[model samples]
Structure formats: structure tokens, C-alpha cells
Target: MNTKNEGVISEIERYAIKDGPGIRTVVFLKGCPLKCRWCANPETQKSIYQLMYWPNRCIACKQCILECPNNALSWGNPGIQICRADCASCGACTQICNSQALTMAGQHKTADEIMQIILKDLPYYQTSGGGVTFSGGEAASQGEFLCKLAKECKKHRISTCIETCGYAKWEIFCELLPYIDYFFYDLKIIDEKDHMTYTGVSNKLILDNFSRLIQAKADVTVRIPVIPGINNTQKNVEQTIRFLLEQAPGCPVSLLPYHRLGASKYDKLDMEYTLAELAPPSEKEMFQLKEQFVSFGFPVRIGE
Candidate 1:
């Protein structure tokens, strides 16, 4: 088992739907290894904590530039350039900026400290059959912290779930399986080469760990993000159906059509939105995909 202590989480989102079986408190951990082009939560991409700056919100008063000790903040026509690599997340610029443009992404908290916040919604959990879900920026990237938190949730008799890309080692998944009641595993593309082309890593480890989970009879749900012109083709869908039938016939599949909801977040993070012009799949396209999955006798959900 990997015993390294990763950084603690940044935020806990309570009463979340579409994450698991019931109403869930999603603990948003702050690190990931992959540089997925369509990543919704771009702020969580980095391994370390970061502060996001909104260019529109800035009044161009140069308050932030003056306050930054490292000279990381500079004013250009594009607004402020807070050098992410050089600037420490000291919040000095964020404090001086009155427009609420500069904001931090992560916070350090102990497992017990987080649990206290989670348990407050225990009544909702009991009523709605929801407990807690550890989501990312790939939760498995912070395996030790996730494992410890999962154990604590189980000790409280809270049904637990994890939304992961399954990109970590099998040992990491093995250590986590005991505490997780449901696994929301993302299977974006079946073809390893295609997967790597978009998600910046091979799907070999993901596929291997998923097969291991199936052998262990873990409760798993497969998710596919139906990005138009990407994985939404008939061939990709057929390949996915074939893989699922052979590997995990019992697992329910959800087809999540891509959206531009996170496009603005890219601006806030000062990162490029690669699929800026790409529109989400049409309703007709979504239903077509759903029908394809249904043809294989696989239960399908259109979104989430």
C-alpha cells in the first residue's frame, strides 16, 4: 500500500446529484496528473494549490501588481499576468484586489475536520440514500488521503462512492475498494491510442484496474463523455459496447454529452480552451447514442 501523505482537499460540495446513488457530499480534491483538453475543473489540474484570476473583474487599478512581493503580477492589455510557476499562493494580490478577480483554489484540512462538515448533512443522506463521493481532479492521484477519508466515512456507516478516472496503480484501487460502496469509473475511450491522444495518458492502467475491479466484483458504473467529433462516432460507441459486454456486463453506463460550461473557467485559470468552438451534441445526436447503447442491451443515461 502507498503510504505517502498527499495534500488535503480544497472544497466540499454538499447535496450533489448525478454523482452517485443518493444525494452526495462531493469532496473536491485538488490534484491531477492528466491534462485533459476538455477538463471542466481546470483549477484542480495542478498538483499544488493555485489562485485564479478573472480578467474582466479586474478594475485595472494595479493594486494587485503593487502588492505582489515576488513581482509575479504584471499588468498588460490582457490584464494581470500572475506567473503561476513563480508566485506563491500567498493571497496578497487576492486581498488587495477589490474586484474579487484573484481567488485561491485549495485549502489544507484534516480528515476529521472535513468529516465534521460532511456529517452536518447526515440527515439529508439518510433521507435521500446518499452519503459521500470523493471526486477529482482524479481522486486516486491523492490515494492515501482518499483511502483514509473513505475508511473514516465507512466507520460512520456512511455509504461512500468515488468518481475516478482509474488512472492509478491496481494497489491503489485495491486499498480503496474496501471502503467504497460504489465506483463511478470514467471510460472515455476504449482505443488506447485515441485515449492518449486526448487525455494525455494511455488507458492501459485504467483498463487493467477496471478488469481487476470486475474480478473483485466491485460495484462499478461506467461513464463516457460523448464529445462530438471525438468519441461520439458509431465506431467508438460500438467498440465501447463490445468492451463492456466482455468485461463488465453488469455495470450501468452513462453517456455524458460534452458541454461548454467549463469554458469560462479556462479564462479564469488563464489557460487555453482547446474545444472553444465545439458545440455540445444535439438532442438528436444524444438520443442516437442512447439508442446505440440500448441496442446492445446496456442501460444508458443521457447525461451526468
Candidate 2:
């Protein structure tokens, strides 16, 4: 049997609404291959710890620059200049920053350490019918660790679930399916070219995996993040509904409207915001998508 020290996790959030049934303890694993233009969790994109700075928190103290051991932090006319290439994310600057302007993204914790934190909320899980949900940066990307953690959760009679992009190997997904009671699967653009254009990867693997999950009869809830001017069109919604109907006929789908919630994070990471001008879909647009899915006789909800 594999030990619990194998898997590395970043954060464990309890009482999450959008992950699964009732309340949930969402385990956020770091690392992702896709670079979606409007990703809400940009920090999870990288596999290692990264420095993040908030301009609003800076009091012009310049303490971070002096404390930075790698000389990566420098004061500029505008604010501070952090050399990404030179900075190793040692968190020395983050620790000394009295204004809390600088912060670090990832931290390492074993599966046992994670499970201990999760079990603390067992009472809430029991009353709410919620369980542990392993989310990503693509949980299947770290399949070996996830599989072991799922088994451990099962041994303790704790319900388990996984929220995935479905861009993973079939064998790895299959191994974890039995351990997962419910799957919050994401279905973005149906067109291969459009999918690759927006999310940096082809939808072939995702579609194939969805089909496999249906064949294996896994309990799944398909989630669609409805972004305006991107996938909020009638054509896209129709195509998505058709695909879901043919693949997982009666499975419920949730339409998640896009928001500018992650826009601030892009600035903190010093990354350009591609969808800065793009606004979220209107309530009418979201209702239109819901109506289209309802016409197909499939159970649908507006949000989590």
C-alpha cells in the first residue's frame, strides 16, 4: 500500500458551496496545463510557490525590497519591481512586509496532514450531507496522490468527490471513479478549435473522458462556465446540450455565469488580463441558456 506522504496539496477549504452536494471540504491541488483567458484561480496554474503582490496593501515602506535575500524586490517609481526569474518564493519578503502587500501562493502538505484538517469538519459534513471534494488545477493531473487519498477517505467512511476538467488518462480516471460519489465535471466549448483557442488544450481528451465516464455509469454533474461573447451564444449552448444529451442523457448540468472576481488577482500576479473588457453575461442571457437545456428535458440549475 502506498503511504499518505506521496500527494502534495496547496489549500483545504471547508464549507464550500459550489463543489458538491450540500456543504463540502474542497481540497485545492496546485498545477495545471491549461491557460484559460478568464481563469478565476490563476495561482493554481503553476506547480510551485509563487509571489503575489497587492498594490493597495503597500504603504510605500519598501521593507520587502530590503528583506529580499535574492535582491529580487526593488523599488520603482510606480511601486515595487519583483524579478520573477530571480525570485525563488522563499517568502522572506512576504514575512517582513508589515503592510501585507507581498504574499506566497503554494505550500506543501502530505495527504495525512490534509485529512487531519478535513476530519475536523466531519460534524458539519454529517449534518449537511457534504463530503471531501478534490479540486484542481485538474485533480487527475496528480492521479497517484489523489487515488491514495480517496482510498484513505473511504477507509474512514468519509464520502469523496472530484471536480475535474476531464483532460486526463482514462485508466487514472477509472481508478478514482469508484472512490468518488459524485463528479463535478466541467464542459466548456464543444468545438475543438474554439476550445483550444480559449483554454490552451484540445477538447478531444475531455470529450472522450466524458463518454468513458458515462459508459462506466459514474454519477456526474456537468458544469458550464458561461462567459459572454465567448460561449454564451445560442450555437454553443445548443451544441453543448446535444453533446450532453447524447453522452450522459439524464445528468444534471449547472450553468455558472462568469464574473470579474478574478480580475484583481491577475494584477497581483503581474499577468495581463485578457478579458478585462469582457463583461459577464446578463441575467437574460443566462436564463436563455437555461431554457435551452430545459427544452432538452434535462435537469438544469443556474448556479451551484
Worst 10 residues of 1 by lDDT: 1-10
Number of backbone collisions per candidate: 0, 0
Please give the TM-score that candidate 2 achieves against the real structure: 0.96
- Give Cα-based local distance difference scores for all models: 0.85, 0.85
* Model 1 residue 295 CA deviation in Å: 1.4
lDDT of 1 by residue, 132-157 (tens): 99998888888888888888888889
Superposed model 1: Cα runs more than 4 Å off: 2-6
Q: lDDT at 258 for candidate 1?
A: 91
Pairs with backbone N, CA or C atoms under 3 Å apart (clashes), candidate 1: none
Candidate 1, lDDT over the whole model: 0.85
